[model samples]
Target chain A: MYVGFPHMGNAHIGIRGLFKALGILTIDLPPVNRLTVELGAKYSPECSCLPFKTVLGNYIQALEKGADCLIMLGGCGPCRFGYFGNLQEKILRDLGYDFKMIILEPLDWRQTLRQLQETFSPVSWKQLIYASRLAWGKTVAADTIESFSHFYRARQSRPGIITGIYQRGLEKIDKAYDLASLRTIVKEVEGEMKAAVLPFEPEIKIALIGDIYTLIEPYVNYQTDLKLGEKGVQVERSIYSSRWLKENFIPWEKKKKRRKMLRDAKGYLKNMVGGHGLDTIANAVRYSREGFDGIIQILPMTCMPEIVAESILPRVAEDYQIPIMSLAVDEHSSDTGLQTRLEAFIDLIAQRKKDKKDYFLSKVHEAS
Target chain B: MKTKIGIPRALAYYAYYPMWKTFFEELGCEIVLSPETNKEILDLGVKEAVNDACIPIKLFHGHVSSLQGKVDYIFLPRLISMNTERTVTFCPKFLGLPDMIAALDTDLPPLLDMRFDFKKGKKQGFKGFYEIGKQLKHSYWAIKKAFQNALHAQYEYEKLLAQRVTVQEALAYLYEGKELSKPVDYSLKFAVLGYPYAVHDRFLSVDIINQLRKMGVTPLTADMVSSKRLAAQAQKLPKDLFWTFSNQVIRAALYYLDEEKVDGIIHVTAFGCGPDAMVDKLIELEAKARGHVPFISISVDEHTGEAGVQTRLEAFVDMIKLRREQ
Candidate 1:
């Protein structure tokens, strides 16, 4: 059985590595592009959020390439994501596609294990352990490289140099056959990123926070991080797939940070509005306290939890005196509009920082 | 003078207001209900609420705004689960409503934000009511009696629904203690599916039920169907929907198509509603394949024009009528 999964940043790379290590055939999905978004929008519910449509489009593309089974993460509601598996299955069936969907629900270990056994029978416990380790290593390496690139991209003298290095780093990590090579590539990339010459320091620091899908998927978000980095702003995203995996999949790992974030979120939001609603609010407050210049909240247009978060975010921004820009994106979101708004927001942050510095200097002068 | 308890006449208010009213009144609190949604209220909601929120949630914001500074405490209960059979959560807006309202920059009364999760039993719900009673300084026995009364009233109100009374008519009768006129038979039956707020609110649904009635069509809503029957019909699906109201609407549509033999289905959903985006498609697909019934999904929002809705409804009804003749 050839397995296929939707692209979530570099998650597919880790997934492919895991399956390969387990000696299984897997179908490489085509990278998400305009065609994927168009196809997804055509088949999806008109008002369904961006992630649902794009993922559906990805599945269709993969299915055409001989993928007989699809693996998708499942959620339990208050968010549209939980219903994606069921809805996508119905849509695909209606379109006359033949495929098996394996929805791995969080906390449903028995179901997950059963599906895993059915898919990979005659596999020993040792192989499972080995494959899991390899997948984890790939994910951590990919995330570390991507994070390093964000810092380097903002500080580098040339515009595209860091991005080029980051892409090459990812390619090398992807080609690595085992843990040793993956570790070597990661270390080499880290060294290269560190040695890069910086012409000037990043003036503006912004925290990216919101729905996990839109935050990670550059295509859906119009590559806001890249755009921000190009404008000499350091972008720190609060949500990362690697961190999420550690918190959720690793049984022994305590979610101390998550608990603390939720506790901080209590001042603004009392309940789990589902999806990363609490995280969005909590991270906004944390980033503000940590003296970030601004916060950008990006989510799919019809996303429920993000809407809730968006509603409460203005107050958080006001209380903390931090500027926030919320971008509600959908398939039809214009690239030019997003770019203009982002540029204006960055300019505003830069101006505010200069004004604050001037004010502080004047106060010091008055004291003297 | 009694302490004023504000209740926004949106969301679950149409279904549960009678109980809340009775319970609070028994606790020596005078209830201040936000007036029926109007253009001004809707405008306020549009201005104050986040742009992406559905019309109903926005209307809820309007209701809350209207109650601001007029009452001592706003009774905005966080309804997590109305049913115990499955983990049927409400929409995210409902779950986070109290926080949303609190975060609003407007001057607001203190909120009695009690959580109502009936998944286990009335024990949890009663505990919430007991907390409300304590806030009002009522005795335990008094709170218990008041809780029993509220439940009885809610039961009676539900009985009206079981007998096929429209929610508006039932609510009027329940509040005013007036007798409802006998129901009139109509030539065509159309199952109207939506959340209680969307369907019951005169402003939100554009009075679709009455319009259907004028066109010689009887509207069958989810509330009219017995909960047990709806649950049973919903069980035919591969898995239970997570949202309680979404599950109800899906089951109602399934029942109407398979059992009620309705001529057509009119599904009124809020624009950008996540649950409806999924459930509506499922119903539409089933209606086409299995039942061969014509289904029209009406997506409502703050900016939806009444004329457009009317035109679409007329066209849908006309097409169904022509199909019947054929």
Candidate 2:
């Protein structure tokens, strides 16, 4: 049973192949879909979005296939992914499902190195290096393929062509026996996808805000991009991969925060004043300023940090006149209602746009 | 020269509203209640509150926003503690509501931060109330008399209810020209037991009474219990009561069982409500041990959806029916 990455940069490309090499019984399902979102939402709570429901739906799908253990990625950030695991466990338990949940918490460089040393058993650098290289290669392949597909989906004139194309491409990549074959297929598909150009439509935009995991993870978020793309909506999702953040962005942020944020007073008060961190508010404000359609605030259920974000979402909605539909995505959330809410919100967005247009026209008429 | 005071139909409303109401009236200050919450009020709350706030905090915003400029000052009672142990410290939101209110867009009257210290019984709590009354220009003797009369009025009101009397029956003695007790064809027991704000805020759990009645269950509120006795029983939980109101709910559950044992208890809490997180668990455990009492805990936050709640209530009722047949 080869398991796919739960979400985002974790497409589990090489990871699944490695499991096969290690004789691990791993099975990968087709990534999450809207129906999966619907099913999850039906049985789930309303505070959640499609992604939370989709991921649980994915796991439920996985369990039907005889998988015993469920593993989820973990991280600590403003979004509240850290505590979602505990809630997910409770939710699954509430539904009478039990399985092992291995939570892989994000680690610093030193810890990562130490973990690698431990996984090597008897501490051989060569074996660890080889494993690392193999995983890295698979990741590159997965990222490239997935990105190409997502990009294609975004640009395609047709609503759902890329989803099918990616489905075919994923099967092709999965069937490859060796890295050479995988690389060869990737090269072939990459060329083909690159050639399949899409139309440029920058009219309606939707900003995805929440924990980074649910935003980018196809498995977790139920391939929300596909749904958005199918609707011919341009999506701008928050991209804060934990690995990327720790390696590339964290130091820069720490340095900036230390100089500007010694005590929590600035950060705390900013959140205290606005109800989430000031930065998130600023980011949403920036999105508003950039003239995005509307801000979609999403996060896991029972998450505290994101509560701060939820508290001030109305302010953003009020100030920007950009109807914000802040979603609290917990495991219990329903899919149909979420979709309906999103659809309703989009309807409001259209009306708001029309209202603005009418206002501008009326002003011009008055001047004439 | 007594200016009227306003009390929002919010936290501690169902519990101590009579006392607060009677007390104010005794002091010759007319009291006005903030309107019941609606979508407009909820939207106001959502707009006024921070994004990441608990449901009750949002509901509080709705309540406060409703009462803005309605009375001389909306009473934001900071009922810090009523007992020696401070057994319950409400969620940071409740403790900081005074500041929370100050942060709102509405021009709130200066808060009546009604701090209470029941360590030496009721002296300090009353003294705090007296100070507020004094500020309202009651004479030394008048304030004392008002407090005593308020206490008597509240006691009389509750005693009548405890005698299985209706609201009208209870008020017949309390209100001189009030109507006679007309027995409400409603007797469904549904302990809306939780921290003060979550239970009292209407927008958060809108149509609760109607919803319960629609299911043919007349809702019996836990707030109608004796707070002092209930607070004592609240200490029975695994985690010591840290918030004053949580203790009240725990004790209310106890009193409901030992006194007016209801068929079921619906423990309501705001989503991400810290106290109810532990308190609900304790109540469930304690309530379960006392026999086939069906208990359900419903957590509501800003994004509260109705479908699941309806299902849960239906399921809980079914479960209760099953137990009854057995």
Candidate 3:
């Protein structure tokens, strides 16, 4: 059983597919949101967010799905997500949810020899490598198709239908497992899809900021990019196909380009300015420079990075004269209210562009 | 001859360095700290710390490793529980740090666990640092005198602080023999409630003072808050506080929120503390529900790289700004 939070916007189906392909029983969890929060809060210790929700949710969900060993995802950067597995295991065990947990800390090149020795000692190298590759491929496929769907949904005509078609085509391409063939599929189908979403000459451009997973994944964030695209907005995300490739693969050493996967998260972690905070600010500056009409910052309720971006983003918006809206999502997040606010924000941007005036807008509704 | 004491420049480093540095120096011992929390040091921490441990705990290990060859003794404060009641505790990683660092860094110096309450005296008793001093071959009187001087300096520092002098500023006044007066109205006090180190470290990733000063917001360190006082505040929540530091953090936030008269609160914790992970949502929810005042939670780790911490501080300031504007 693999436990996950809506930490990022990753769809579990593809990941589950990889697990199943590896001859393992995989349970796909219900998309995380406010409901997951309630369930997680009910059983989880009082304070932890991703862990509380994920541990309890994974336990109950996996238990419901009749899982054996509980596996959770992890990272070693700003989010503090790395410790979730151990912490979750302890908390759940105390509550009578007995299960095993796997926390795959990102490889640090310096510690590679030792970390790998420990990691590979437990699992077969073939299975590990295969699982990793599948995950990597799926991340790209999910991110790209999800973005394409979102783009077509909000900004294009007949968003719901056109995006559905685009997603279907993208999925077919993903299953190909080969880049050339997939590219061929896209070359053949993309022209018709782009033609379908017409009036693309001067659509409003929106840059997403906050919580890399939420901004990238469609399942958790409700295909926000697709929704915006169908509504006639050009969705730009910091995560791209090439960057993921460069980070994951570029063969290092005598092969010319560095081919070895970066063992350390130093580049990503020590960046200090990355995470959602750096990503959002950098993207905000980039979007503003690109003359983007607006920016949307999305993150979890307890995230620290987005909270930081929330402070400086207003200044960024002011400087660029671009409208910005930030949303902190949790289980209590209401779809209707969220959509209403997004709609209002979009309208505000469209209105500001027409009037060329300073139009301050807010999506944040204080509990008070 | 002065025995050298190694203080790792990590977690507890940011929190009690001044007190530790001054007290140890006053004892005529050489104080050497592991270099500032950086990539190399943090990597060392991750290597030495338990695989499942939080980044801070891992970093603490790296700090210990760095100080091993250089110092005769390395200080790893094993404060088990500070609250009177068994309700307050620290993260599991903190509780087991001595064994963890010792296991990983075999080349490390004898771990000096300045543990306040690890034994029966783990919660409600005075720590016999005099015994620790004797173990380090220092005369009990010298240890007592050094402790007394350090304690006095800390108390006087607090007096100056109550007059609105910061730790750094008070240090200056004490060192330079200058009279100190607060320029700002000790008004608009915001509690810096979290782990002690993250709040105190001026140069590391999250510069809370600069963050506060940038917006004219007065920052208060959580260290000023006693955990026993905060633990009394934690009675509202029904659960065992296993992680002692987190217990203090919880109590501090709640006490400041309901009783300390803080206008708002900011909780800075190592991003992955289980004890804190156990409580952040409750803080957010509590801050939201009964909050006439707001709470801003910040997570700091070596990975924070400061710029990210700054962004969060800026965002938190904006939230405060928006609230004040309204």
Task: Give me the candidate number with maximum DockQ.
Answer: 1
TM-score of 1: 0.97
Better of 1 and 2 by lDDT: 1
DockQ of candidates 1 onward, in order? 0.82, 0.08, 0.05
- In order, the TM-score of chain B in each prediction is 0.97, 0.78, 0.77
Candidates in order: C-alpha RMSD to true structure: 1.6, 10.4, 18.4
Over 4 Å off in model 2, which ranges?
A: A1-25, A33-55, A73-84, A87-98, A104-206, A211-214, A217-234, A240-269, A272-280, A289-311, A317-368, B1-58, B70-193, B199-266, B269-294, B297-326
Predictions in order: lDDT: 0.87, 0.61, 0.59
Q: Indicate the TM-score of model 3.
A: 0.51
In terms of lDDT, the best-performing candidate is 1
> Candidate 1: where is the Cα deviation over 4 Å?
A251-258
Q: Poorest 10 consecutive residues of model 3 chain B by lDDT? A: B117-126
Clashing pairs in 1: none
Cα deviation of A122, candidate 2, in Å:
7.9
lDDT of 1 by residue, B1-326 (tens): 89999999999998788789999998889988899999989998988898889888889899999888899999988888776865578888888888888888888888898887788889877888898889889999999999999999888888889899999999888777788978898888999999999999989889999988888899999999988788789668866788888888999888888888999999999887888888889998988888478889998988778889999999999998898899
Tell how far residue B256 is off in model 1, in angstroms: 1.5
